[model samples]
Target: MTTLLNVTLTPDQRDLLEVIAAPWLARGEWPLWANVQHHFDMRGEDADAIFHSLPRVGTQTPFGAGYGFTLPMRAPVDGKDRVRLTVAASLVVPKVRPVGEQFVQALQHMIHLYTSRPMHFDQVPTIILRSEELEEALPDLPVWFFDVLPDLLSNEPTIITGGVHTSRRAWEREVTRSVLQYRRVQSVEGYIEKTCEIVVAAAAQYGPAIAVAATVAAEPERSPYIDAGLLAELETAAATNRWKVHKLIALCQGLNDAYIAENPYACAAMIRSILDHIPPVFGHTDFKHVAAQHVFSMKRNDKTHAQRLAAFKDIADDVMHRPIGHTTPRISMDDLPEPIRLNAILNEVVIVMPKSAPPTT
Candidate 1:
């Protein structure tokens, strides 16, 4: 999923952006360095330094001007080490403005090239100007890093070529001819505008999905008893391999899922599994011994909870091993053990687990 990093500019930065964007706002032309110097009343050298210092968007090498800002981000790719990405966008325009289809294709081509290359260039949706009417609308230029996930464009092939040819030289010549044909039919301004529109629409459509995925990622598994934070702590402890709590974690998650689905039988079975699994953490082969002998280190209420948890095993066994009779058996949410009882036991396990070793530099 892609992440949107909102960029907030200082007052001075805002003023500087206005100076850079003035020419485009007035006449749809790229601003000159001289215009910035005149607006700021600075000398040529000083203006040049300031202009270059700013995080610019669009082609700057040949002194082309476009709206938006450059934001640098460190993000992980395909489970590998994090790489630095330089993200940029063009100026936003109203939706009513006509943008050609060819422009969208061209922009997508550029996106594919930049992202696949060693020098990562990430592009996001353009700033959208929200207004009832174009004549009365004010430009809403917000800067942000819109992370485009690799999977979003993974299906698009890097190279497009003509039909199979007998020789490599023939294929290369055919591809060159196609490229020249495409260039002859494309429009520069229309391509830029359409690219911005497509990006804006994509962001709008996928924003909610990305947010939900991010929330799920932040908390791998959650239940009433095991929240995201507690689960994280348990994971950290388990990583050391000293606690041997991986099965305990899985059981806890199973219990949570069963409880949520209102399957009292499954919930009871999961609780029994958890009871049988965590005794080793307390230096006992059986839960009954742990419950009887391990309460001295715990607080009064926690000790009571632990004892109650031990008693719950009988109820869970009855639910799991009971035989079918003439009368039908029924179970409900009330038949399950209290969430706090499990929470107390898990908390104690975390307290006793060894801390993971620190990473070496």
Candidate 2:
């Protein structure tokens, strides 16, 4: 009397899984079986199917895809975040004589093939989403923003014409909106410097034109938050329009997209940095078992920040034109009806920025 969990796969995911199952699914062997509940369209029984069909697209990249509508995945691990005890226990259902790390490695490899990449395991980690905390993460940010972050991580096609610059900047803004609200590193100076480095390196590596535009916009320094030297490097990289991700990754090698994905704004980065700096153990998040791979792709602010600003503004403007749904929009900090609006107004949209104390002298 064991309960089986049924998981659904998208057409693409199903096709991908078929490729991985090939090894185990050789001739003369019994068909591979999955733990699917014996029922037709029972609500929770189709959890796997529903998760795959989510409106937002998911990436099958070696590095795990973040953002987009993700189904909650939980498992009990040894440290801070553990896969669920029950789910982890399910792996033994097949009753292998020696079910251990080797078995686990096999399963992971199978997953990698299905994903179509030899992504570094260290880089790609299974992230569990916290339904409650994620709600808070969306605070003034729109939910749709999450769906687009994965797109930014992918390499754009070679055929698109020159306007990739405009689109690339737009993507940066959307990415910024999604992560700027999350936790990040403590120092803003260290953050922007690293971002510009990544963008420039991306450009020099023959990244798309939009990618180059993102690097160009991030190429110079005006505000104190950025590093001038990194800006110079980006400018030099710009001349050739070629970048190397590995080389540039060294700049802000450690920053998380949630922590350093956007321009350095004392106000925006305030709460996010606090979150990024905290050890995950003490932090409040739905992802109990998170791997060490943190950070997202991002851009830095410079004097040319004007174009960067407008790109993001256009995105925000576009969002304004869409239909509002069951949930009230987030962009309107003021729409926060009396109770919520009261505090926002009092603080002047500064969620974490503290007001300066008068006359400290």
Candidate 3:
């Protein structure tokens, strides 16, 4: 017996699917029927519903009003029944290729449409709650920040005017209308949450695809650990080179954020920036010559410099070098916990810089 997996769809998703499904669907036949079974071994039993509901090719209807379709589609798994897949129409089409890329494209387009629609007052709170949940659930996932959160936040209209406008009524009707319509609050706590849930739900449907996207899109997170001692040393180091203090401070901030986000590449880049600046500050001028000397040594007074310098150089090299078309070598978060230690060591190197030369006449 063939297994059947059920896929769910939101009302809006079902409607949008109907529009895209028109080309592949025919009144007398489903063009995609053989393709889906051949490729995915899946079948949509209700193909007629889609074709029967489509308006003529050239006709137009109010956006989202005329199309209709059913969802909870079925697919087989492991030659026996398994979990239901909540697929959209985008996922339904046969020609959609290369392992779910087409599905994401379709989903993103629908997201554009969903967010563009005017939201009701009652739905705002739910969206905001959902947004917070998604943020908390996927703190390091860039998709939540870049795609989902922005969509939710932008969905709520800040202004109340110009939509389906109506004039104030005459005395009999005006006096009795609800005063609530005139009152509006600035809270967006709800709108964002609901939009977050929607995006997350879609991500869950296309888990592998979204996960890959998240990895590509993610940035470094902020580190929780701050070193007072290191910070003080950096401040003092910056005193002589006050003009360059901003760059140092920015590096520290970037490092902290990267460490927390577990972004190894970003963390390494921050280290490399400080390393590249070191030789120039003290007039060594040649990075290739002095890079190893400073990185390999601890100040004579700092006993742990040998171990720390060795460790820091090992990590720095992994992140800084790429032979060709390859990823950075480092991956683990073990070294990220104490970036301040490395920063402090770099500050020591900076302290030796000769003050700026007197201006030449």
Candidate 4:
């Protein structure tokens, strides 16, 4: 029988589904009620209610006492959210029958393979038979059965397997090899745990100051003094060794904020601080050494840019050490170092720094 189902969800529910469904959607697999329960942190009955509320397609295996259901899920594609259908099959077994741990592990392994790569097809076929006997005794079922089976399957019983289209066979083979050999963080939970540890460590190290600066830096407005792309490169380089560059990133953020606010004195001081902070990245003890000795090969005007930056140090010193007098001193936006000079130094830093190496298996 054919059926059409439509589900309407609240904005919050849709957002939650977007997160819970991402990995399953990426693999073109429908999440079972148990998967939904884990992600949503809901009780079994509630998860079942929600799962059944969504649209589904149902079928039974021709050769075995197996039945399955497929669900339609939403995911973002080409910058727009779209709904796609996914298939999954399971056997009907007596409640007294105990599923083996080996079977459970094989299913998990297959899922890990599917999720570790980018989406290859709009739908992946899946079949979960009852036992090895059932899989071995299987006959050639109708074409529709192949249409509903998964691409990557564990061969060892309880056997899971699927047929792939000719176009996808090559990709499937490569994916299988790479995923089996190089995959790290075996499960989704392990990956999440590692990510949380990194975040917590960063929070403890940078404290609230860097966090606040990051928030300010994320604003849409471009800073007149700092090139955002160059700053991002510096941030990436620093991320490899955060203790060395946390202050530098914060200084850049403060400088950008000061320039946007037209606080010329603050801008001068921050620029001076940044010049003082980044010399070590270039293997120099001080900014003066960086300015005088560091070779700039990208452009002919780089020496002149370095000279201008060196001059700004003196200007900033005047702003910082000039004693308060009966007559107040004046500093204007024009007095700040030219952006080109600072950008030249930043570009050199990005070019000189070693990038973080890719993680190894």
Error of 2 at 82 (Å): 26
Give the per-residue lDDT digits (tens) of candidate 1, residues 51-101.
Answer: 333332222221122222322111100112221111122222222122223
Best-fitting candidate, scored by lDDT: 4
TM-score for all predictions?
0.37, 0.16, 0.29, 0.37
Per-residue lDDT tens digits for candidate 3, residues 1-361, read 0001122343433443444344333321222433322222234333223322221111011111111122222111111211111122223434322112322332233333334556687663211123334334445544313222232122212211112112221111111111122133112212222222333343345332121111212332232332434555556766666335567667767776776567777877776675565555545554444534543323331224324444566667766675656653546766642443454455455455435332234
* Overall local distance difference test of candidate 2: 0.25
RMSD of 3: 23.0
- Model 3 regions lying over 4 Å from their true place: 1-229, 236-243, 286-330, 335-341, 347-361
Ranking by TM-score: 1, 4, 3, 2
Candidate 1 TM-score to native = 0.37
lDDT value, residue 170 of candidate 4: 23
For residue 329, model 2's alpha carbon misses the true position, in angstroms, by 2.0
Q: What does the lDDT come to for candidate 4? A: 0.46
Q: lDDT of each structure?
A: 0.45, 0.25, 0.36, 0.46
Instruction: Give per-model CA RMSD.
Output: 20.2, 25.9, 23.0, 20.2
